[model samples]
Target: MSLNGKVAIVTGSGQGLGFAYTRELARQGAAVVINDVNADTAAQAVAQIEADGGRATAVVVPVGTTDAAKALVAGAVDTFGRLDILVTNAGILRDKSLLKMTDEDFDLVINVHLRGTFTCVREAYAYFKEHNVRGRIITIGSPTGQRGNFGQTNYAAAKAGIVGMVRTWALEMKRAGVTVNSVIPVAATAMTKTVPYFQKAVEADERGEAMPAFFRHDLGFGTADDVSGLVAYLASDEAASITGQAIGAGGDRLQVWTHPEAATTEYREGGWSYEALQENAGTLFTAETLQSYGEEFLPLPEDLKPAQAAEAR
Candidate 1:
């Protein structure tokens, strides 16, 4: 009950990963504000939390606008009297390759994931600063954001942008003693159910079977609930010094992702001309010396290979 007497707001928390986040916060003794577009699911989430002997309320609204963000903070204070933690978890996926992705597709994803997080965090931080509350702000990110993904151009951009914002906000909020961090979660939820490996894991879970070790251990994919503990940890008093970090969590693993940094730097007096650069290009920059481009998709064992991928391989 480290979070006892605290109030929290988790957006897009009707179900899936967002729901798990709300439940965990409530379990930690925070009175929670569950925000979702679907009234039914939002109500259901509140009911579930209440049944678990935790206090909660629902705010049913789409979460990308300033109005909705304002309403959520208002809802938290009106319902629970204050806001101490905000999990900007609302997001949507528009999975299309660059060539096939439309402007509408890109904008829609950005509107929800990036703009929604921005508005919500902006409002929540204002409340924290005004009240002198040492608040915790946890923003959601994705593997696709940390590294390039094949067909998630919009998703990657939005999620990566979220982490970028977290780093900046952490610096800005440090004086107020508020912490801001990104949670890069890899879990089997509605958004990931379509992935072959996650599909297999979901099927296994539905059948009351554990996910294969390859997924949990190596791939870092697990049930949504498995990722909730990290969210809860970040929301607790113990995480006060853990700002500006991108922490990854899943089945059996937790990771600290390094902030972006220059891989290699070399000084050139007067900045070498094209002819000088050409002479040094091979020694300084080579295919073998560059960093990796995308997330590692380890080779799945024969029995664990996803069906669609099995056929192709």
Candidate 2:
């Protein structure tokens, strides 16, 4: 009952990680608003919660539209009488490499992940402020946001933007006792299942397609429940002091860190003179470079299966 009597809204809760979060929060005595673009899934989620002796209501909020997001906030507050927790978890993936990515692909992801989150959080904050209620805002991010991934430029960028928004909002909302944070999760959900590469990985495991020796030691694919545990914590009263932080939870692991480390100043008072910068350019490009260079690139895993590898094996 960590979140007892709290009212929460979880976007995209019809299935996957979002549904798990909604169910668990309600179980902990929080009344939850379950939102999904799919009407049936949202209704089913609410039904399951009610059957378990928990309180919940489901509403459909299509991804990427401001009107849908505003309506969702209104519905949650209208049903529950107030809002305490907001989980901005709704998103979609238009997988493609940057070269192959269309403007539409990029915009679609941004609209859902970035703009959609903004709409929900913005309206939720207004309600919180007007009611003089403290609030918790948790956004769903990804490892790709921390480390760039091939074929996920749009997703990565949108997630990275969430981190930025969290940090800025944390500062702005501090006086109002509103906490903002992000969670980076990896789970075996519909989103992952739909990814051909991930699906292949799961199938390969089932078929003994080069099962690694580490499989015995390593925790297997995470379920939605696993990620929901962290979500439950962040939504609780105990977590009020924690804000502007990211918790990476997946594969039964949790990691917390303050990102965009501060750097030593080599930025001298002068326009970019090639010679002056060259002297301390190395220092300038330390771990904390410009915000534009938000994330660092990592090489792909040696065991990663390429398209050709799938064909060959």
Candidate 3:
């Protein structure tokens, strides 16, 4: 899908997935605004896009503030004449177990990933309403949010909150012909390098070494470019009907995640007593009836048993 004459503002576009999204949208004929906290990286990204014959400008500002977010949208309109798309891809990692996680760590991640997305979308939605444009808002999510990860309470909570915002905004903006969606990516990037196994696999791939058989099934699927293609499609007009959805992109795999719903319900003619609930709770909340939210990707060696894995941690 072509995005000619469209103007897109991608936050944290100086590097990683945000950069990939900005470049892809620009390459597809959109004027992109590169927003990042680092001025040099933002300028470098703009320069690279311009060198490739794409139109782009840089906005070096932190995304977590209301003022900064408004400035970002204003910059886009001032530079490109209109705002059409917003990609909230700025985030930070502050992984720690629940007991060990500090308030500052939790607040920082939420500020960047969840609140930052909210501020940007809020500003962009105002602009879209003022101009009567059918804008597209794409927020970034993470697998850790869908399936909880160890030592990542802050990051997982922030990512999950982002998805919640997307769903709510999608419903609110539908009448205005604007669309909102979330993209959960599982690509190998600098952010994923924090995990020791992922770092080793990336380093090995860079050295032209083959990954072990255990990791062969999933390692080195694709980079940020692979994720950007899905984001670009969602930004295009063809995906106008596709809102309030969470999409996953990695390597060649694209998936539509199921929305939360009631699997089953228990009711009575009158309010049940504590004794009744205590007796029936066993059957109502059985392990077999509950959905699992554990991590699916086990990067551990196959020879490691459950007990050994626990011990290793």
Candidate 4:
């Protein structure tokens, strides 16, 4: 798990999960580019990594912008001479149900998650392609993308989009030897813990008021480090063959295969037509409909059913 001589960039590394990823990668011998909107936090993170005898430099930029994304890559290349790994871990949440969701809220979330990820991936792809380099791209996804969660319509859609992006990029970059994958992590972080709603959810669960089926006490919940470990592995050369994958990581648990179940369906032919299509559309669209759309197969082991394991962790 040594990243010796590797040049890596981690967005939102000023704190939380991104910070953990940056520090860990630096500690593993990779020259890290720490990115965040907060200059002080980013600088402090880099300083801490350096204090631990790790190589790191901070780049203050809002990761959702295209220019900033390019700057992040350029900074990595300029500082370390090459770009090897990228972790697009910058994101924000504006949780709201579809009905209650505002356009501004939706735009903000999409800009951060989908647009932000696109910005980073596009720049990295250009670098990797131009340099004829094989790079590793790992994005942060959420369980909300796997199983729908209440009050997170925007988050879920964005996360699901990331998985789709990874799949497409994996194929597009295959010729260049780059691999694209996403990590669907369940971690307790500042973003989650700081949210009043989230705190209530956790408190409720603790009081046995509305425990999620996957709740587990000994699993110690999830932390930033837990998710970073998986990100590190995905970016490693050992995982070269593991592109277009969505993995789950946490304490006392590691479920790499997280996807919707499958089923058969039908579609209406053209001219048979608007009314008929409208009536049958709901039946045609389901998690089952999406199962065959991707190339990777990472379904969980039969005994490790996700629904049941919800209790263990």
| TM-score for each predicted model, relative to the true structure | 0.96, 0.82, 0.90, 0.78
Of 2 and 3, the candidate ranking higher by TM-score: 3
On TM-score, the candidate that comes out on top is 1
Q: Residue 133: error of model 3 in Å?
A: 0.6
* Candidate RMSDs in order: 1.5, 4.4, 3.6, 7.6
lDDT of 1 by residue, 1-313 (tens): 9899999999999999999999999999999999889899899999999999999999999989999999999999999999999999998888988999999999999999999999999999999989999999999998889998888889989999999999899889999999999999988887777777566777887787899988899878888888889999899999998999999998888899998888788788889899888989997787756888777777768887678877897
Q: How well is each residue in 56-159 modelled by candidate 4, as lDDT tens digits?
A: 88888887889989899989988889999999999988987789999999999999889999999999989998988788999988777776677888888899
Model 2 lDDT tens row, 1-313: 8888799999988887898999889988999989888888888888899999999988786866768777877887789888899999999989998899999999999999999888888988988899888999999988888877779999989999999999999999999999999998866676666654455445554464542322211433455676888899899888999999988886546778559766454456766698987887787876657455333323334464446556786
What is the model-wide C-alpha lDDT for candidate 4? 0.79
After TM-score superposition, the amount by which residue 55's alpha carbon in candidate 4 deviates from its true location, in angstroms, is 0.8
lDDT of 3 at 219: 40
Residue 75 alpha-carbon offset, candidate 1, angstroms: 0.6
Query: Top model by lDDT, which number?
Result: 1
Ranking by TM-score: 1, 3, 2, 4
Q: List the residue pairs that clash in candidate 1.
A: none
Error of 1 at 148 (Å): 1.1
Going through the candidates in order, what is the number of backbone clashes in each?
Answer: 0, 0, 0, 2
The segments of candidate 1 whose C-alpha lies over 4 angstroms from its true place after superposition are 307-313
